[model samples]
Target: MTSGPAIYGNFTIDDLVYPNGSTRWGVPGGSAVYAAMGALLWTKVSSIVAPLGADYPITLLDKRIDLSRCRSIPKTMRNWGLYEEDGRRHFISRNESRDWTYFSPALADAASGYQAAAHIAPLPFEATKQLIEELRAGGTKSISLDMDDHDLLGNRSLKKMMELVSTVDLFMPSQQDVLALFPGKGPLEAMHQLRSLVPEVALIAIKCGAGGTIAHLAGSEEYLRIPAVHVEVIDQTGAGDAFCGGVLGSLARQGDLLEALLCGAVSASFCIEGMGFSSLLEATGEAANSRLERLRQRVERAPCK
Candidate 1:
């Protein structure tokens, strides 16, 4: 929020295991990085408010991103990411206890005196709720939350999820999260049910991974499902986080929900084309806008049936 928007999440060292049995070590990975890069594609400034470990590669972040608010911690999160043939991912923490105390810091203290739209990556339910309350209390203009499936499928109840989302302007959950939150239901139906549960959220989007996304505006009968941009898949680690960045960044800058959605899809397209967020971070505004135009042509309103 120093020069522009900010992303709050964790930074991690990722050791990736591919379905083909290939291995990549010492990769920079995290939702915060991917989300910032996604926003940086269209916005001139995107700041990160997260803990940085000594071993993390600071150079991996683009020059446009601001690290002024990032705090130094004993260690950032570290994990091994394993990908399956169906694109399902399994994670194993490198640290015995995961030692994730750095994951949820005092965000309002870290990002003091800032008032801009913010995107929050997945965190524990209580931690996320506290951050949202603090951000709102600090006069943050807008908030977008992307939840973890584990949190949804765990002890966090649907009612608690509803309560948490009501405080934010945007709520984007992956397709897996939606299904788990509403068992025995499809994405669209889950979205509808969620809308009924919390009608105050301005926008609710369900990220369908390679299948694209379906989004609904509060109080509207219509919803739109946009297709993902075709790109050779490399690693899907941070695609969904990148998508949230694009959407929140665009919304904060232009105040256009639909345009935000398109930007998100394009952002995710760039994410999947490389390990971690390398490809996504390499994208420029012109390249992103070009892809947005092409994606705009393919967008169609989904049937409400």
Candidate 2:
């Protein structure tokens, strides 16, 4: 294993329709981009491994992000992010080239030697599983998995989800994903059930958009509720992905999940302050740490009921 982690996901050109009836077109975004930005806030040694194309603007990305592992393709994936007043979002593919959205076996094999930690962003069920397995085989120090709502709602059964969760050191799912896995239950209630359901997972975090994140670590009876840092909400497109990346970044540096959660909260706050990742990209580590210092005052730690 090496010093820094490689984040994997599909690169996309997102056209976002905000709830306030504002529109932004041809925005450079994707899980890997946002996550790498988040991680870079804490550590500069982050690398992104994804499929990029000629259509995507490579210059928009920060120079600190290592792109040598990214696969170069002919066309980038494009999508429309439609948002409603109630914070509901729907993604529609704007590109016919869906096959380039995932890594081929050879690509996955090539990425396996990256060492360090790896964060597999939300991908298809089988593809996510395959990447996790390959990373594990390649001796990654730690692996984190993010859940896709489509994967949970579709053919991926709870049994299969549990199996996948069990294989990773960290399992981060949104509140919606938790509710889907345990219907008619609250996120915290579902979190408790998930911990018991998959005892092998070292950390399980339920990301509640405005309510913040409910995190539980293995062998701990208490749940940590990391509140979201209050900030002007502009475009919240990649907040969750940034949160996961921030967690991994802080964990890599601070070596404490509690501190990592605060880093994530601060990271997400910066992510929503502007359109796309503009605000986050503009933020410096010193600026982020200042926000984290103030946010640390608002953190509430309580025992799981």
Candidate 3:
């Protein structure tokens, strides 16, 4: 099998608060970790560029993931995810007042000269744009971005978002973030609106949790909706990130968008089966391939029009 593309993103320590009055403190979680895990199932991860504090748990990461370029910063990205009984989730940054910027000469140097596909996980819009710009300049072939809810809600700048979208090959945003990005518009309408803004974007994947995923390839008139796989829900923390990683990794290795989407959907199914990365960690490539084949058959039976 061909080696997977080089993936890059940040690692974060998540403090999850459940409605049952229980808290899982300082758990190893983040877009980078989740994405890396999903990618690792298919191919080797090139490197993870993250800010690691002394308190961050390095043992949780799989040994196959490369972290030689990761930085040891004074503070790691930490956030509190509050799961309410009402089914609403809220994220609060524990280190909101601290500077979380990881862009530097070293970071740029580490990410530079990559000829493979790279996934830029959620971060500030400017920071994301900077990384994309650097990677593109360094001769990276394909790049994907996962838009974070915080960035969309905070920035609220359509122009900046469009600028960033135009630079990436794929743009994956959650349903909530898509709705938040364009108010008063339904999912399809919101996707269309985003397409209007960044018409040059090769693909726009809208992650509708539980409802499935809706994807719009550039030049395709209709959106392709992939039904969600049925599974017992545990924790939905890193599902989107996992999906992003799976899709990018598949695209990098296989170069098939449809197969990439299936990979993403299957990876997300594994994520929600357990809390954090537990289920995903236990998932095997053979199992993933089996699920992918099943999903492909489902898609074929009901081909997107």
> Which runs in model 3 stand beyond 4 Å of their true positions?
1-4, 19-21, 84-88, 102-115, 300-305
List model 3 lDDT by residue over 190-222, tens digit each. Answer: 887888899888889988888788888888756
Q: Which stretches of candidate 1 lie over 4 Å from their true place?
A: 107-111
Candidate 1 lDDT tens digits, 1-305: 35577888888888899999999987887888889988877788898888777778898778888887777776668889888887667767786427554565465544455848888888767778888888888889889999877788898667887899899999999887887798888888988888889888999999988889989988777888889999898888899999999998888889999999999999999999987788976777788889999999988686565
TM-score for predicted model 3 compared with the true structure: 0.90
**Residue 218 local lDDT, model 2:** 89
User: What's the lDDT for all of these models?
Assistant: 0.84, 0.82, 0.76
- Angstrom error of the Cα, residue 47, model 1: value is 0.7
Where does candidate 3 clash, by residue pair? none
Of the two candidates 1 and 3, the one with more favorable TM-score, higher being better, is: 1
Per-residue lDDT tens digits of candidate 2, residues 31-55? 8889888888898678888777878
How many pairs collide in each candidate, listed in order?
0, 1, 0
Number of the top-ranking candidate, with TM-score as the measure: 1
TM-score of each: 0.95, 0.94, 0.90
